[model samples]
Each structure stands twice: as C-alpha cells, then as structure tokens.
Target: MQEFTLEELKKYNGKNGNPAYIAVNGKVYDVTNNSHWKNGEHHGYEAGNDLTEPLYNKSPHGDKVLSKIKQVGVIKKD
Candidate 1:
C-alpha cells in the first residue's frame, strides 16, 4: 500500500469534490462514496485525518467497517 504523511493526507478531506479518506489503525480508507461521509465530516469526525482514536473510542462500529471500504493508503508516522 502507498504511504501518506498526515500533511499529505490532509488534501483528501472530502470537500469540494475531493475524495474522502480517513486513517484507522495506520491504514487509510476511501469513504468517498459513503453518504455518511459527505463533505468529509461525519458525526464530528473529519476526513483526511487519522481516526484511529475515534474509531476505537467514539465509533459505534468496530474497525471491521474499514474492511468494506477501499484502502487507498497507509498513514505514516512522523
């Protein structure tokens, strides 16, 4: 998989026709087609950012949800 820095990941914020992507467990997923992710903001979570914390602590579902979405890349640590 491709690797993306947090800065680079910020570009795909699901805004202005941009693709929506979020990182979970260091893996990046493209949620552009999901209505819940419209405009890249879902339930206070913004796209183009590592959502591992929220996914584990705030989400109703588990990481398994990412299995259904397309993984476009991985989030690289600084």
Candidate 2:
C-alpha cells in the first residue's frame, strides 16, 4: 500500500472533484463529498484535537464512504 502524509491527505479536501481518505487502524476510508464527515471535521471535532476531550464522537462510516469513492475509481491501489 502507498503511504500518504497527513498533509497529503488534506490536499484532497473532498472538493475540486477529488476524493478524501483517512488512515486509521491500518485501514483507509474515502470520505468524498460528505458534508458531515470530513478530514478535519470528523466526529464534530477537528483532526489533531485532544481525543480525551468531550467532543462530538460519532462512528464514521469510512468503509461505506470508501465504497462510494471506489465505485467511482477515486480510491485505487497504487
């Protein structure tokens, strides 16, 4: 699998017709075109925030999100 930096992932932004992905637990998730779930806005708290803090913790449908992007060939093995 190709490795991507956090800054590289942020470049996607789910805008400009590009897909987004988040690497967690050795898995990649495609969150493209999702208004609610985004790279920095996942779980209502921005990325790099303190996990212990009382923030919006929601189950991110990353798998499902990846499926959508894969269907469109946005996320592919490099």
Candidate 3:
C-alpha cells in the first residue's frame, strides 16, 4: 500500500473535482463514490481528515462500514 502524510492527503478533499479521501486507524480510504461524501463533506465530517475518532464515537454505524470501501493508502506520521 502507499503512504500519505496528513498534508499530502489534504489535497484530495473532493473539492473542485478532486477525489475525496479520509484516514482511519492509519489507513486511507477512497470515498469518492459514496454519495454521502459528496464534495468531501459528510454529516459535518469532512474528507481529507483523520476520522478515527468520529467514526468510532459519532457514527451511528460501526467500523464495518469501512470494509466496503477501497483502501488506497496509509496515513503516516511526519
């Protein structure tokens, strides 16, 4: 898998035709096809961000939802 820094991943925020991506548990997922993630924002949770906490605490669903998406990269530390 590929590795992406937080800053590098920020470029894919789904705005202006860019793809949307989010990091969770150090993994990066491509959510561009999910309508819920249109424009990189979903239910107040924006893409190009580390959503480990929000997905765990705020989401009505569980991490099982993550299994459906494609993992494109990893969120690496600086």
Candidate 4:
C-alpha cells in the first residue's frame, strides 16, 4: 500500500460529515461510512490517578488519539 504524510491528508479538506479517508495501493478513499470507525468512541479511553486519591479516566485529545491510530497502522490517508 502507498503511504502518505499527515500534511497530504490534511489537504483533502474533509467535509463536515466525512472525517476519514482511505489509502490503498496509492489510492485515496473516503471511508467515512466504514463500520470500523463510523462511531466516535472506537478509540480507547485514558486512565489516571488523581492527587485526591481517586481514579480518573477520560478520552484523550482527538488528534492525539488519531495519531496513535496512525502509528499502529490502523488509520492512514496522507
């Protein structure tokens, strides 16, 4: 499959209803409706301990979470 830099992906000017693109064999695909990532919560959560002696958990930043997905070869467009 072809690989692209993050900059190239950002140039697509994704539509409001489409947030994802696919790249296979140097081709670009707008897989916004793909079942794999159609939902927003597909990304995992984050857990941390608070100074108050309690546990805290929340989702990471969208960009950070997406970056991790790219690192794992789960998502890539540009």
Candidate 5:
C-alpha cells in the first residue's frame, strides 16, 4: 500500500484531471469514481482533505459508507 502525507494528498484534489482522494482515520480512499464525490466534492466537503470528523460525526451516512470505496493508501506518520 502507498502512504501519503496530508500535504502530498492535497495534490490529488480530483480537479483538473487529478484523481480524487480523501483521508479518514489514517486511511486514504480513492473517490475518483464515487458519485457521492463527484469532482472530488460531496456536499460542502472537498476532496484531498482529511474528512474524518465530518464522516464520523456530521454526515448521516457515516464512515460505514467508505466500506464500499477502494482504499488506496494510508496517511504517512512522522
């Protein structure tokens, strides 16, 4: 598996033909083809950012929704 720093993850913003990726609980998932993450965006949440809080607390769908998505990597530890 690959590892990404938050800064490095920012580059894959699902914009300008970039692949969409979001981090949650130290896991990085590919949201490039997820309809909910069209253009790397869902609701007001943008891709290439750590969405742990919103996915765990704010979104009704919850982190369970990520189970269907493909995990590509993990957040790099210092």
Candidate 6:
C-alpha cells in the first residue's frame, strides 16, 4: 500500500476534481464514488480527514460502510 503523511492526505479532499479519501484505523479509503461522499462531504463530515474518532464514536452507521469502499493506502504516523 502507498504511504501518506497527514499533509499529503489533505490533498485528496474530494474537491476541485480531487479524489475523496478519509483515514480510519490508520488506513485510507477511497470514497470518491460513494453516493454518501458526493462532493467530498457527507452530513458535515468532510473527506481528506482522519475520521477514525468521529466514525467510531459519532456515526450511527459507523465505519461498517467502509467495507464497500476501496482500501487505497495507509496514513503515515504523524
């Protein structure tokens, strides 16, 4: 898998023609094609962020939705 630093990960915010991606459990997932992640934002949750805490603690749907998405890479320890 590819390795990305926090700064590099910010580039894939699903905006301005960039692909949408979010990190969770140290893994990066491509949400660019996900209906819920359209335009890189979903219910105030934006892509290009480390969503580990929010997804695990706040989301009703949880990180289970990530199973359907592609695992693109891993975030380098900051």
Off by over 4 Å in 3: none
Q: Between the candidate structures 2 and 5, which one is better when assessed by TM-score?
A: 5
lDDT of model 2 at position 9: 53
Every model's TM-score: 0.90, 0.40, 0.93, 0.30, 0.96, 0.94
**Candidate achieving the largest TM-score:** 5
Model 6 Cα lDDT, one tens digit per residue, 1-78: 999887898999999999999999999999999988889998898999899999989999887788899999998985
Q: Of 1 and 6, which scores higher on lDDT?
A: 6
Error of 3 at 30 (Å): 0.1
Q: Candidate 2, clashing residue pairs?
A: none
lDDT of 2 by residue, 36-61 (tens): 55644555544322222232234444
Better of 1 and 6 by TM-score: 6
lDDT of each: 0.89, 0.44, 0.91, 0.33, 0.93, 0.91
Clashing residue pairs in all predictions, respectively, total 0, 0, 0, 2, 0, 0
| Candidate 2 or 1, higher lDDT | 1
Cand. 5 TM to true fold: 0.96
Global lDDT of model 4: 0.33
lDDT (Cα) of model 5? 0.93
Candidate 3 lDDT by residue in tens digits, 42-78 = 9998888899999999899969999999999998776
Per-residue lDDT of model 5, residues 1-78, tens digit only: 999999999998999999999999999999999987788888989999999998888988888888899999999999
Off by over 4 Å in 5: none
What's the alpha carbon RMSD for model 1?
1.2
lDDT of 4 by residue, 1-78 (tens): 444454454433234543555333333444344454543212331111011111113423322323233321222433
